[model samples]
Target: MPTNGWDTHMHVTDPSYPEAADAEYTPGQHNLSDALSFESTIGINSLVLIQPSIYGNDNTLLLNALTKLGTRHGRGVVGFDTDATSFETLQAWHQLGVRGVRLNIKSNEVNLTEAELQERVTRYAKIIQPLDWVLELYIGMEDIPKLEPVVADLGVRLSIAHFGAPTLPPIGNRTLPLDPYTVAGFQSLVNLLKAGKTYIKFSGAYRFDKDPQYRGIEGIARELLKFAGDRIIFASDWPHTRFEGLDIHPFVEKCLDWTDAAGVTEKVFSRNAHELWDIPLDK
Candidate 1:
């Protein structure tokens, strides 16, 4: 772990908060203490608490965690009803270390038509423009091609979770055909990277590969590095809801190994996050 790095994505669930009635899956309870403990063990000192789909628009748990961690050690990204959330509410959250909003499309089971998707992204982008915060999406690889045009020139930063959460084609019974070129919407994703308004998170390898170590996915990272290593951000994807029991120790090493070879380990692991999220640790 980068001792001064930020885990830009992760979630903490408290059972006291009511779960969304239609939550895709309830996460096993992971407290703020537990999250801090694990990250400390790995040598990571900062965190970003992402609002899990199960929490819907309720951010009580998230706010409490942020209050405890404060801006010096924590920042947050929340999920909200775009229509219902007020500017005052967002401003309040901003003061408490909330730096972004997320569309839980993948986990919340959103199936917007291409036009609907475009409109939605536009709304979110426009809402956060004044706040200088990012608009994050939990969409899949296939959605990237559809998402690129809408986000390309939005003038606000959009961060994609889990390397686009790409589901690559299987090569054979024993081999993984994990090439980004073989994946849908990859070029569109790269196009947005080049356009300079997007950030790609190095996280959720388990979503791309079922292997515990997430083997054979370096092609995706290398290609991402090739196009925009400086824009890449590393995250722990902590407690790893939906994909439990994953040994992330080696997986993180693999990401570093690749970034080191590309000569952007510092950028990906530290500098990019400090810039994109405006984390204030160094100051």
Candidate 2:
């Protein structure tokens, strides 16, 4: 394990804080204490506590956790209405360790037309431009190719979460063990990675490959590692929503495989996160 590591994606849920009225999932009590304790054992010094969809824009839980973690020590990817929200509030959040905004189109399963998708991300890109923050985009596998033009001129830091695909319902017919290689717009996403237009977060292995070892979809991960490793970022995705009680070590070890080279692991785990969060390693 690297002496300093960053788990770039994870959620912390509290039973006391209710889920949104339209919440699709009522998560269990995955508290901050347990998450931090587990992370400590794994040599992870920093965290990117992402805002879960259950809470919608109510990031009280995430901000509260950041209060405990201290600024710069803990970072977040939160959700908010870019239009209704003011830039001052965003700057306040930045002071509290929020480095980006998460545009979670995947959770609501909303399909946007090319014009609509472009409008949405473009608006967000413009909103966060001044902050120099990254946009954590989550969209359907089919919506990715549409992003080619969006990123070509976005001129902002952004990342595609959960490998940016495999949110696809099913490839052809088979469901559970979907091969990420077959994900719609898979090649276009790779091209974006190669062009350094956006970053692809390699997490959520259990989403596609049901096998604990993720053997079925190893090919897809390997292909990205081979071609776009420079833009790849590994995240533990701890307390993996809907995929609980799973050992993160195995998934982290899988990342180790993808990041076998000395320089590769350093970039994927620690260095890349620093660049993304704009936080110093010792912070």
Candidate 3:
């Protein structure tokens, strides 16, 4: 393992904190101590606690965890209402180790027009540009193409979650007919990676491939590694809200197999995300 390995994406759910009224999923309690313990067990030095969608724009739990966990060992990616949030609050969150804002379009069907979605991300990009932060997205597999130009033109770092959430083909073929939106989105994601305009998180293998060994998912990982190995980062996706009772070790090991190059896991697990978020490495 690299000395400063980081789990770049994960969530913390506390029952006491209460989920948003409109939350699509009712998450059971998963808190700061549990997260810290998991990281320790994995021998990782730092972690990035992403604000779960259950909390909506209220990031009290995430900020409190960052404060308690200390900035050196923790970072946060929070959700906010760009329309109502002030720059001062954004700067304050930045001071507390928040380096990115999440735009989770896949959580629920937002019923928004493409123009509305574009306007929303554009506003967020403008707000965070000064802080040099990333816009972390959990968009649907098909929406990637629609949002590609907005993210590219916004001039801020963009990180796509869940291996770009590729639309899977039928088993055995490795290549098959794909829906127009899926094909377009996957191709756009590849083009963006080639241009060094975006980054991908090699996390949530279970989301893409349900096999215990994560067999079929490797094809997508291989493609990503082939295109932008340097831009891919690893995350445990711990406390895997929708998918718990799944051991992370196997998934963690799967991250290393994405590329055959020596020390590739070291780069994806430690260097890529640390550099992207400007986390200080242990000497």
Candidate 4:
């Protein structure tokens, strides 16, 4: 942990909670106890509880966790009906330490056409813009071209999940296949970073190329670091969804090594996250 540093992305899910009826999987009653204990033991002082997909639009678990963790130590990004959520609800959540809204496409059971999804996201962004809350996206890098323009026009800050999850082309014949779609999407992300229109999480390493040492994600991480050092933040993805019981110490070490650039590790692990999530802590 980075002492009073922040973990910008993590979740609080329990089996006792009401999961979405059509959820793909049921998370065991793993609430904030483990995460809180782990963070305390490791010296991390704050967290941003990202709503997991297993609960769909239900934010009960997330909200309760935030309350328990207290505003000073916890903030959250919750899932809600973008179209139907009331302004009062937004205000209330903000008062209770919610700082962002999530638009998760990965692991979502509900299917909507591209246009419909974009429309809802736009609406949600508009709703939260007045509160100065961010829109956290779990979509692929390929969708950036289509989505970025819409969000840019909306005038809301964006935070992308999982290192943008670049779709790397297959390596064959001792040659790298730089797929145009993936390449373009990634470039668009870089453009967004340079423009200060978006931020990204240096998280979910397990979701990317599963080379045990996480060597495959280096290129993307290095690229983002070059464009925006403070815009990149770190997370443990604890409880390590789907891949439970993961020892995150190695991943933490990897984060430090990969961000070995002067002062970059501090920014990624602490300063940047505090700014992004508005953790109530001193500079």
Q: Which candidate gets the maximum lDDT versus the true structure?
A: 1
Model 1, poorest ten-residue lDDT window? 169-178
Query: Local distance difference test, per candidate?
Result: 0.83, 0.80, 0.80, 0.78
Question: Under the 3 Å rule for N, CA and C atoms, how many clashes does model 2 have?
Answer: 0
lDDT string, candidate 2, 93-204, tens digits = 9899998999888877777889998898899888888888898987765788888887877768779888775544433455544455676788777778888858888888
In candidate 2, position 246 carries an lDDT of 76
Which lDDT value does model 4 have at 45?
63
The Cα error of candidate 4 at residue 171, in Å, is 8.0
Model 3 agreement with the true structure over 105-147: per-residue lDDT tens digits: 7777675577888888898899999999999988766677677
TM-score of 4: 0.90
Query: At residue 166, what lDDT does model 4 achieve?
Result: 64
Residue 128 Cα positional deviation in candidate 3, in Å, after optimal superposition: 0.6
The candidate, 3 or 4, that scores higher on TM-score is 3
In angstroms, the error of model 4 at 127 is: 0.5
Regions of candidate 1 where Cα sits further than 4 Å from its true position: 171-178, 281-283
